[model samples]
Target chain A: MQPVIEVKDLCKTYQDGLKALDCITLDVHRGEILALLGPNGAGKTTLISIICGIVSPTSGSVTVDGRDIITDYRFTRQMIGLVPQELTLGTFDLVRNTVCFSRGLFGKRSNPAYVDDLLRDLSLLNKKDQEVRTLSGGMKRRVLIAKALAHEPRVLFLDEPTAGVDVELRKDMWDIVRRLRESGVTIILTTHYIEEAEEIADRVGVINRGRLLLVEEKHMLMRKLGKKRLTVQLKEPIARIPESLSSYDLDLAADGSEIILTYDIRSSRTRITALLQDIKNAGMTLKDLNTSQSSLEEIFVSLVKEEA
Target chain B: MNLEAVKVIYRFEMLRTWNTLMQSVASPVISTSLYFIVFGAAIGSRIQEIDGVSYGAFIVPGLIMLSLLTQSISNASFGIFFPRFTGTIYEVLSAPVSPFEIVLGYVGAAATKSLIIGLIILATAGLFVPLRVEHPLWMMVFLLLTCISFSLFGFIIGIWATNFEKLQLIPLLIITPLVFLGGSFYSISMLPPAWQTVTLFNPVVYLISGFRWSFYGISDVGVGVSVMMIVLFLSACLALVWWMFRTGYRLKQ
Candidate 1:
């Protein structure tokens, strides 16, 4: 399928010689939630800013729905909605007025019914007439989302949407994002929260030091790079691994009461049966056994560490 | 041309004025009325008229010009600067609106506010002293041109200002001083030839002189020179604003 947004060989270098993005290329498909996972200052905001036309790229190009962002900026921009990291709302404007203003600024004719529906979706209908300053932080965030969607944009960019939000609100925001996707709006979000990507993102892209390390399907990435560890608790304490079980590369617990073995889940041969038979022949009975897979957080940390 | 975008921005800015009616309209009127009482009534009672017009009536155009210049600058500057200051400018920059559309909305609203205040001050001057505008059409022309040109200048200042201090700097330290020295209270002819020549260099002189001529049918300088000066200043401000938007100076990085 043709991507909704295409960033080709994009590079942005500031005047002070700081390279914010370096030869980065990405494609966002229609109606998919693509989470850009990165640490602070990893250029996630810069990438979004470039695509949204808020910041100019020093070299390379970006297009939205086959229109170049620079040459056909009007069409491209009209199709996009950006929720910046900051609250960025006028303090005195009414919630409903602010959203309507956004729609109007995009050259959309005023539609009170549509705006009211958008407010209701964000749970801001009650605060529609209230000044923005009167709303709580979460409500303010919802206001931002409502404003972004007021123009009925096809693609939405949320930069650190859940930053500083409480867990309950974060969950609510996730539900909102999912609903937006269901409405056929492509969503691209940048976040450092690993679980945020793990929970909602269909595909995840890991970025570090202005470079895109990799982009893969969330579960596929997990299953590919994920390692499973098998923990075996012996009935009796063992001082060390037996000579026969040494080939299995077993690690003894600190108290010598448990044996642990880590293997790649992708590998065809885990050698679990052989290890179990060897343990039985060695006269060691197993009290209990359990296994756990690596989480996205651990994989993210390791990837970032490798780049560093 | 995105006229809708322009209208949206214009309406948004005008709504801000409506929300702050006291500061936008009432404050300027009250202060200009005070000026009429102090300079036109109390002080002019002792001083004779410089031209055929009354000292009280003669100062009307000058006072309006003074408020117009300053208010136009402040309104436009703050209109654009607040967005940048509060980070709300991203909506504008990311919108499908062009630079020209953005300027039209902001400068248009700012000029309208200044024009309203100018007319109010004019009516107030009539109550204080008999007022006569010999060429009412010319008076409106000068008033409108001054508002738009100065509002454009103010828009440039808004984009150039980095902090609140800088935002107020030009209006306070530069434009305000120029309006005073530009014959807002006294005609330039009252000064010696050398001082008069120096005063002509102050751009506010042309604005006030042109506007005052429309009232009394007399001017220290030729009416043509004053009109030409205004057009030249307007064009220069337009060029500078165009360049600023094109280069994204202090706006986009």
Candidate 2:
């Protein structure tokens, strides 16, 4: 299927000679959540800003649904919603008024019912009449989302949605995101939290120093780059591994009470059964055994580390 | 023409005015009344009529122009600059609305405000002096053109300002001084020929003169010249605004 958002070799350089983005190429498919994982100033926000038309690209092109972002800005912008990382809001405006104003700003006819439903979905219905300044940080963030979604855009770009939110609120935000995806809205979010991406992102893209290090399916990436470790608790304190198990990549535990075997998950032959038989043949009994696969966080750290 | 987008911005600004009734509406009315009390009732009682019009009556157009110019710039500049300051301008910048629509909404609301205040001041002046309009249509033309032109200028100021101090700079330092020295209270004919020649350099002189001519059939410059000058100024402001948007000056980074 054609991607909902297409970015090709996009670049942005500020007047101060600082390069914010360099040769970024990406595609966001419809109704899928693509999480962009990066540290601060990793060009995540800048990339999102360019696609949303908040910042001009120094070079290259972007298209939404096959329409150029610049030449067909009105159509592209109308179809995209951006919830910026900052808590940008008018302090005096009522929550409902701001959302309605956003709808009108997008040239949408007034629809109070639609706005009320959006507010309710964001759990902001109770505070719709309250001034924006009166709400807590989490509520203000929800108001931003409501404003972004007010025009009923087909795609949503959330820049660090849960940066400063508490854990409970963060989970709530993730649920809201899930519901949005279920409604067939394409989502592209930038996040500092690895767990946020792991928990909700269908695909993850790692960026560092203005370059896209890698973009791949979350589970597939873990399976490909991830490693699994098998720990064997010895029945007795063994001095070392037996010569028969020398072919296996093994490490003796610090206290000689356990032995760890590291192996590639992608390898067709794990030789686990042979290793166990050999351990019994060598008279090294096992008290307990467990295995763990590498996590997305570890894969992310190694990717970013390798880039740096 | 994204009329709905324009309406949204215009209505949002108008709502702010309504919410701050005291500062937006009452303050201008009360201040115009005070100007009449001090400059008209108190001072005009001592001076003789000039150009066959009472000192009090002759100053009415100038006073209205004064308020219109300052208020137009203030209203429009603050309308846009406040959003930029608070970071809420992202909504405007990121929206599908065009630059022209944004300017239309903001400048339209600002001019409407100045126009309302100008009319209120006119009515207020009537109570203090016997008002006359030799050319009522021309009077309205001058008032409207001045409001729109100055409001456009104010919109430029809003975009150019980076801080609160810069926001108040042009209105307080430059615009107010020009209005005062532009013969708002005295006719340029009353001055020596050389000073009159120098005073002609002041753009506000043409605006006040044109407006005063509509009221009393007297002016320092031809009514045609006044109209041309204002149109020239308005066109220049429009060009600058268009360039600002095209280049995404400070609005985009």
Candidate 3:
């Protein structure tokens, strides 16, 4: 099956000689949630802006649902819905008209029912008649989502959808995104919170300094790069790691109340048994032990740092 | 270009404009009425006809043009500027609506507003000045031309402004002073010959002069010159606005 969205050799250099994007190319499969993770100024918003047709590409092209964004802008734009990072709305506009008119702007025939259903889904039914300026921040963000979904586009781009939102509202928004995916809408979202991507995205793409770093499946990435840490509560406090055991690169913590051993999960020769034997030989016993695999947040930080 | 899109956007834009109808239409009508009350009744009582027309009658055209110019510019400028300042413009640009649709929705609404307010001011001027129209159809043609011209100008200003403060720069500094100094409150013939020569440089004087000609069949400046100046200004503003949309100047990013 063809990817729902294809970006090839995309590049953008602003008039003032700022390189916001390099030769970035990637395929976003249909009906999957893909998270674009990058540091600030990592070209996340720039990429979305270009695809949305607000910013012209300095080079390359994008195809949405097999339609060229530039040559077939009307058709291509009809399939894309973008929630900009800016929480901007017509303040004096009513909830109903905002969404309905947005649908009409796409040349779609009036579908009051679709708009009504969308408003209900976004929890905006109550505020449909109210002025937008009077709505809460969370409500405003939801309205943005509603406006994007008004035309029932197949692809939705959420540019940092959860930024500057309260925790409860963030969860609510996450649920709405989940429902949208269940309806077969391909979602491309950018996020500063690694855990958001980890929780919802089927795949992850990391970008830094206008360069594509890596793209991989969420679970596979974790399994391939994740390191395990064994926090062993020592039976007795040891002042320091023994001279012979220093080869393991262990950390003796807080008067030896615990010891930390970090090693790759993929390594078959983790000296766990040997370390236990050595601990016994050194006249120490474990009080307790627990293992933890690396998190996506850690991997993201390390990847960004490595790129830098 | 799509009529459906235009109607949708126009209705949305019209709704926004009506929210401030008092500023755009009603307030101008009321203030222009006072101008008739004070200028036509009190001032005209002493001053005779300037050109075979009562002092009250002479100021009617200028007063109508005054409301038309100010309201048209404010309507179009604020219509575009508010969207930019509030960042709703991004949503519009991101939508499938063509730039033409955005332009029409805004400029059309402002032109409609200008027409309404211009007519209202004319009607109110009648309650005091006992105004008479020799060519009612010509009045409409001239009024619409002025509306389109100034609306285009304000549309360009809106696209050029970066902030709320920037939006005020042109209307307050440039448009208002031009209208006031353009013989909107008086005839250029009353000024000294040197002052008339200086006022010739003010483009707005020509608009008022031409519009007044459409009403009374006489004007201090030649009607041909006023019509030519108006056509030139309108064409220039239209070109700039189209260029703004084509290049996606400040609107796109």
Candidate 4:
């Protein structure tokens, strides 16, 4: 499938000689959720801003569905919707009017029914007539999403959509994103939360210090970097691992109450059966055993550490 | 040009004005009426007439022009500046709307607001004194041209200003003083010969002179020079606005 957005060798340098984005390139597939994971000031917003035409790239180019963002700005911009990180709203405007006005900004004819459905889906129907300034933070965020979707854009960029949101609102946002994807709208969101990307992103791109470290399928990335650890509790405290268990890479707890064995999940032979047999043969009575797999957060920390 | 986009922005701005009716409309009208009361009643009592026109009538055009120029700048500047201040300008910048459409919507709305206030002040002045438009057509022409030109100037200031202080700086320190010194209360012809020559260099003089001429068929400068001066200012403002959008000055980064 043709990518909905293509960015090539894009770079941005501010007037103060600060390099915000450096030789970055990315592609967002149609109807897929691509999460850009980065620390603060890692050029996530800058990248999205360039594609949405809010900021001019210092060099390189971006195209949406085969049209250059600069040369064909009107057409390219028409295809995009951006929910900025800032909680910017027309304070005195009614929720309904704010959403309708956003639709008109895109030159779209008024579609009150669509807006009504959108508001209902976002659970903002009750507050439709309320002035924006009166709504709670979460409700205002819903308004931003409604406004962004009012134009029915083909591609949407949510810059830190769930930042500072409560857990319930965050989950609601995830559900909303899922629904938008179901409707065939391509989504590119920037987030620093590893769980956020792990939960919803089909593809995760890691960025650090103005450079994209990697972009890969979330599960594939997990499988490649994931590690499994098995911890065994001995019936009695042991001072060290038995001589027979020397072949295995094992760590004994400082108190000698448990043993931890770490191994790559991707290896063809886990050798678990042999390890269990060897453990039984050594006359070590295992009271209990628990296994845990590395999470995306661990993988991300190590990845950023390696680059640093 | 995308008329729908322009309409959206224009309507949004005009709605903001409606929401602040007292600040946008009533205050200016009331203030201009006070000017009619003070300068017309108090001052007009002593100086009965100037250059064959009643003192009260002569200052009518200047007062309207004064309020029109200041209000036009303030309305347009605040209109655009507030969006930037609130960071909502990103919405407009990111949309499919072009720079021309953005300017047309904003400047157009600002001019409309100022024009309404100008007409209201005119009507209010009529209640105070017997006002006459010697050339009704020319009066409207001057009113519209002034509205558009000053609004455009305000748009530039809106983009140029980075904070509230800068926003009010030009309108208060520069334009207001220029309007006052430009003879909003007294004709430049009434000044000494040397002072009159210097006053002629004030750009606001031409705006007031041409507008006053439309009311009384008399002016401090030739009507042609007045028209030429306003057109020149209008072109300069247009050029500056064009450059601002092109370079993304203060609007894009």
Error of 1 at A67 (Å): 0.5
In model 3, state the lDDT of residue B172.
86
TM-score order of candidates, top first: 1, 4, 2, 3
How much is A89 displaced in model 4, in angstroms?
0.8
Relative to the real complex, the DockQ score for model 3 comes to 0.63
Question: Could you estimate the TM-score for every candidate?
Answer: 0.97, 0.96, 0.94, 0.97
Each candidate: chain B TM-score: 0.98, 0.98, 0.94, 0.99
Best by lDDT: 1
Runs of candidate 4 with Cα error greater than 4 angstroms are A242-249, A253-257, A266-282, A287-290
Computed on C-alpha atoms, the DockQ of candidate 4 is: 0.86
Q: Tell me the deviation in Å of residue A156 in model 2.
A: 0.6
User: DockQ, per-model, please?
Assistant: 0.88, 0.85, 0.63, 0.86
User: How displaced is residue A32 in candidate 3, in Å?
Assistant: 0.9
Please report the candidate that would top DockQ against the real structure. Answer: 1
The CAPRI quality class of candidate 3 comes to medium
Off by over 4 Å in 2: A237-256, A266-283
Per-residue error at A233 for model 4, in Å? 3.9
Residues A20-51, model 4: lDDT tens digits: 99999888888999999999999999999999
Q: List the residue pairs that clash in candidate 2.
A: none
